[model samples]
Target: MDALSRAGPRARRAAAAPGPGPSPLPWGRFAAWIDCVCVVTFDLELGQAMELVYPHDFRLTEKEKTSICYLSFPDSYSGGLGDTQFSFRLRQSGGPRTSPFQDDGRYNREAPLTLQREAAHYFGYVYFRQVKDSSMRRGYFQKSLVLVSRLPYVNLFQSLLQLIAPEYFDKLEPCLEAVCNEIDQWPPPVPGQTLNLPVMGVVIQVRIPSRVDKPGSSPVKQFNQENLLPAPLVLPSVHELDLFRCFQPVLIHIQMLWELMLLGEPMVVMAPSPTVSSEMVLALTSVLAPLRYCCDFRPYFTIHDSEFKEYTTRTQAPPNIVVGVTNPFFIKTLQHWPHILRVGELRMSGDLPKQVKVKKLAKLKTLDTKPGIYTSYKTFLHKDKSLIKRLLKGIQRKRPSEVQSALLRRHLLELTQSFIIPLEHYIASLMPLQRAITPWKNPPQIRPFCQEDFMKTLEHAGPQLTCVLKGDWLGLYRRFFKSPNFDGWFRQRHREMTHKLEALHLEAICEADIVAWMKDKSEVEIVDLVLKLREKLVRARCQHVPVREETLQRVGLYIDTIIGSLPEDLQAVLHHP
Candidate 1:
């Protein structure tokens, strides 16, 4: 019976359902004939399947043939039924077949039948025979089917014929054999080898499809064919497709390896010789390009023996993985052992504050003198030192190359010359005056700076005052100063402090109260006060100021006025130089 008719009650139920269902025949019959039938279905396109099975040697007997079939018979029946067995085959039946016998088969002594519907129009057959004398009455069926459809095969063949003459197959055979031989000759990866290098030749094979159809003519015709005359039908073998498939896993593995390289771990690549091909270098660069902007220390690639030694000896270095490529051409050109490595360097110079002081500034009248000036200098010095220390520590932790170390050192030196040295000099200039100034606890009976006390005070300030002369008045100096502009920076600071000192000195000299006190004093006392005033002016002048001659003359005239009012003898004595 045909598959749909044999489906019986199950087929009617399936047909009544709303959507497509499993073929009723296959589902029901699978259980009855499960022991004997092994049905294999090929999901491949019909033309491809036929090409694989029939190839060029075998030709179809007829163009109208639509199906290929297979059949098998059971050797024995179960339950001592005396060798009664069932058989079945698939054929191109035009319409459904049915039996006139009753469903139970008791009246006609007929065999049991089952059908499995496959693709839309195909069906698999199973037949069963009852064991006449056995206690178990169920029949056994054995069947095998190989069905090849005609539509797709005919279409594919017709297209092929239009594209090229049949003689193409004869010319293609040797090329196919050559490709298969090449694939067979490729060495399998070494067992347990940590680095499996890619074979460039195999990689080249995958490019065949793209290169197949060139501009003027096809690539197939270019292949060496010495004895046979060239013809358009003589195409290159399809075995190249197989070779491409064989290399697919290697390509995938290489891609994965590229991802791992992005982790920025240290890597060592072993080459069979001292130098690598330009192609290999290009490949390596492409793999590493993703990490070009990374801020961390870059992975190293080098061919130098010393570098390899350094990498091995440095315990603090990142773990190194060995990389190798399978191409013997590359291998022979690369270094043998302790291979070349490439190391990456930091690309970003970290952002640093333009001003050294990170902290907020306190309000102050002037940085020209006293504690305000001294404190500002000290604060900036400490901030710069801290910044330098932090940067150095980061460099050490990152383990930068020697070139990077030198660059950082140069930067630090520039910072010192620009900001630190001038600050130190300014602080030194202010220290003595800062220490000498003291507040009085009680009013003194006599002026604090008479000639006697004045010389003593001057003696106390002498050593520190000398320091001003010894230091660079033009500004702080360096042996090999790169910044001539630093001289201007220093001079501007000194000029501000000198101006403050000049103002203070002039104010004391012009004080009305100081003149009144001089008038009341004895000639000797007046002379002594004048000397003290002169000493204060000298101190101010020493601080890089050009003390005004007019101011000095004015102070002398006031002392002369006091002397003019004194007795001639006293005046003469006071005028004694």
Candidate 2:
């Protein structure tokens, strides 16, 4: 499912698109919080600040909702509706919202609770009942007329006040002056407007609607939200809200109402098929772009309910999506690409105003095929079981469910975030090891030498140890003596590696070994050779000093136990027959 859409209701119960990520937001949070809470309880720190996360016994009760009064300004008595309403009363039942959207609950009254009391500090957060279940979302939410005790918040106050109660504007001047003058801020307040709060910054805006910024009296404005005037909020596929719709005024403001999850970066599509919905593709593209990620399916693409979320939560790949065969095979932008699975799907049962609904959406059948679905799918499975095994290897290595789809784009999934940083860190780690161990491949660019470097290093080391530097480096002298059979195996493998590396060498022979032969090495060559030597020696040394039958017997005795000591993932390889 798309990350934005994952915030909706139905996506909760639906299994994630086959092997993509976890369930939608609430579920994902619930799972994580479960583990967190378990630890808190175990540690007897339930009173810790973090323990307030969805704890039990503290949610709303239904009776409290029936007697409360909701706030809404009419043309008769108001120019703008401010945050404080001096009104109260009403009651109803208690329940949690199925989705993460604001204002989802069974309540009869709009809680007139003060931001000062329930949540005092300007930015201090509190999850109090606005009614029974109404509140804001994960992203930045800004109201123009939210009353503030501080002067700096005055212009903001007027802007949103107008949105809530336009008729009350004449009264807004004194409020704006009192506050703005105190802060010595702004060119005063404007009427009939909503503020654009892209990432928490706010600005005063006029009621007129325009897509581009037209310069307001205020100097600061949120990115993508500048010049946006107050208007009926528009979203895409309300269930899969087009979160960007609010900023895309006049372009068919939509509430997507569709669950379209994106990874961290924009997915650069490589497939040939393109029958998928352009809007869906655009939506997913938008999500993945800013987040920096990629995808497997196309737009309006249905993914297995179970597999859907795997794409968003940075989870492991589903068996089929990774292998290139989707269910219905809806041809997409880049082959039968994996789509932002519908992590959520919802249909309203109670009466709802038409102002909130749009009729352009539809449910999609998964384009990825399932087991026993077709010949190609089975063929794909058979051919890539090893690939699947490899793909799953990491997941198994750590927590099987640790794989995360992303809240951003696939490329920028938080799991993959430090990609460059980790690579840099890894390179840095290897620098010292390479300098100390490798006297041949210097300034090691291990990437290019991945395959052939070690083989050559081993081959060179063998000849030097056994044939050339047969002194202190000599096996027998240095306690390197081994069983004949083990020696033969080691020698043979070394020779093969040496031959392959020699064949792969693009330049002059890197034969100048620091131990036996020197002065013929490049920084690159030295680094490469050292890394190769380290791999063989360290792994071998860590486990066995001599490659003899006795060693195997002793080591093999602890094989299962040793592998078990390793991660569940790596154990798979050790356990494999």
Candidate 3:
């Protein structure tokens, strides 16, 4: 009979039950099983095998080396095998037993037929097995494999599908295939070329449990924001202590100094969240310490804070540049100087008036009227009886202050018309005669009647004859008629005024002179002249009551005219002030 018929009902049921023969073990998992068999063969030869394997109910003796010649049944065998029923045999060899056998109650099985064919092609006579307990409940084996191969240090990696959860792998195959196919279509790497691998580029997401003050308190809320974490953290309910024990040797082998020395390049370790625990940071640092001289060993962390909140508000204003000049020269010449130099205004620095002999006048002081002229005029008008009666009638229904102001304005207008106007007209008549008189050779003498007439008009205006008139019309009359050196003073003042007018006329004509002089003068002289022209223009602009735009444009044209005749280089310098 075949092995199935001899094994009773269970073997018959296993052969008839399945839709497929456990599908095929994934390539990686089958290779891992072969590797386990190879290790067992080596260990049993040295009496270091961790599992007791008795062939025909005989314990392996010291110095009697046995090996895993084959781990799977022949193709002719037709029964579903149990976990402990491996097809290994003992072999007698001449070797001193160094290590004692350790029975760890573990066994191995052959891999599926698909993996056996691949193994045979790559490594001659290789065998694979799945280690499991004696009962083999529900056909669930440990996440470990064994392999027997003649090749040295050759390991086979098991696919995660067979080792962990086959159902999950079956479900995820479509998605995984799509991802893998996309990756396969990418451009191939050049031959003999090493890629510049990124140092650390993994993001691990950890979800912190909410803090509560007491039992049954509401759980802390999680932010409903995106990009909170790259990957979800999975916390399993049941703890399997030996779950990772199978990989412990592999981890130790990778981290060993001898293994690292064999590699031409140093290894780098990247962990998530260096801030989480100090021990993890220290451990990573110590592992890379040996390769510090040959490689840049850096450990990076990717942490996302759950409590962090970000907000964007308004921006701050820019800084201001404040330029101040001490003792400015243009303060003396410029009219309406305060207004011209008003803060935040756009006046140029050169247009500022000079701080010379001309005193800085307040806005009120610079007005045409003398100090307290309006007040004195109002007081004088109030004392006049005729003016008072007329003002009372005119402002019968007005407020007291308004009535007073109206009366004062009326009296001032009457004075200006009757007294000031006649005086100005009489002075205007004398200007022609005065101009005709030569001061030195034909100094004209004033008649006694003309002098008496002027005095009579001044005396007739009673209280109106105050300091404003005294400093203005009255002052001029006194200076011309009363002073002993009247002619000398008048002539001197007149000469100064004429000289100023003449200077202005000369300055205007100099533009033409500059054009003429440019032909004969050197570049230095021409440059000096241009500079002087600019200074005069600036000064003229400053002297005006409120510097006129037309005056500035005229001066600017004069400058342009002079500069246009100069050489290109010199013209550029003189083009602007």
Q: What's the candidate order when arranged by decreasing TM-score?
A: 3, 1, 2
Q: Over the stretch 343-403, how does candidate 3's per-residue lDDT look in tens digits?
A: 1111222422111111123432342312110110111111244543454344344435434
**How far does residue 59 in candidate 3 sit from its true spot (Å)?**
99
- Return the top candidate by lDDT: 1
C-alpha lDDT values of all predictions: 0.30, 0.25, 0.29
- Candidate ranking under lDDT, highest first, comes to 1, 3, 2
- Give one clash count per candidate, in the order shown: 17, 139, 24
Point out the higher-scoring one by TM-score: 2 or 3: 3
Compared with the true structure, what per-residue lDDT tens digits does model 1 show for residues 497-520?
556545445555555455556555
Name the candidate, 2 or 3, with the larger lDDT value: 3
TM-score of 2: 0.18
Number of clashes found in candidate 2: 139
TM per model?
A: 0.18, 0.18, 0.20
Per-residue lDDT of 141 in model 2? 20
| TM-score of candidate 1 versus the correct structure, residues matched by position | 0.18
Question: What tens digits encode model 2's per-residue C-alpha lDDT throughout 1-577?
Answer: 7774665333422332222344334333222111111001101222111212122222323222111101111101122222322110111134332322112211101211110011111111111111111233322121112231211122233233334333223343343333222222221112222322211133333231122322112223233443454432322111122322211211111112111221121222111211112223334433322122222322222233233344334344232222221233322322222332221112223321112212111222334322111111100001213323433343345422213112112222221222122222332333323223332332233232221333334434433332221222222212212223224333433443443332222111222223333245444443444345445344444433334444334433333333444456655654572
Worst lDDT run of 10 residues, candidate 3, spans: 371-380
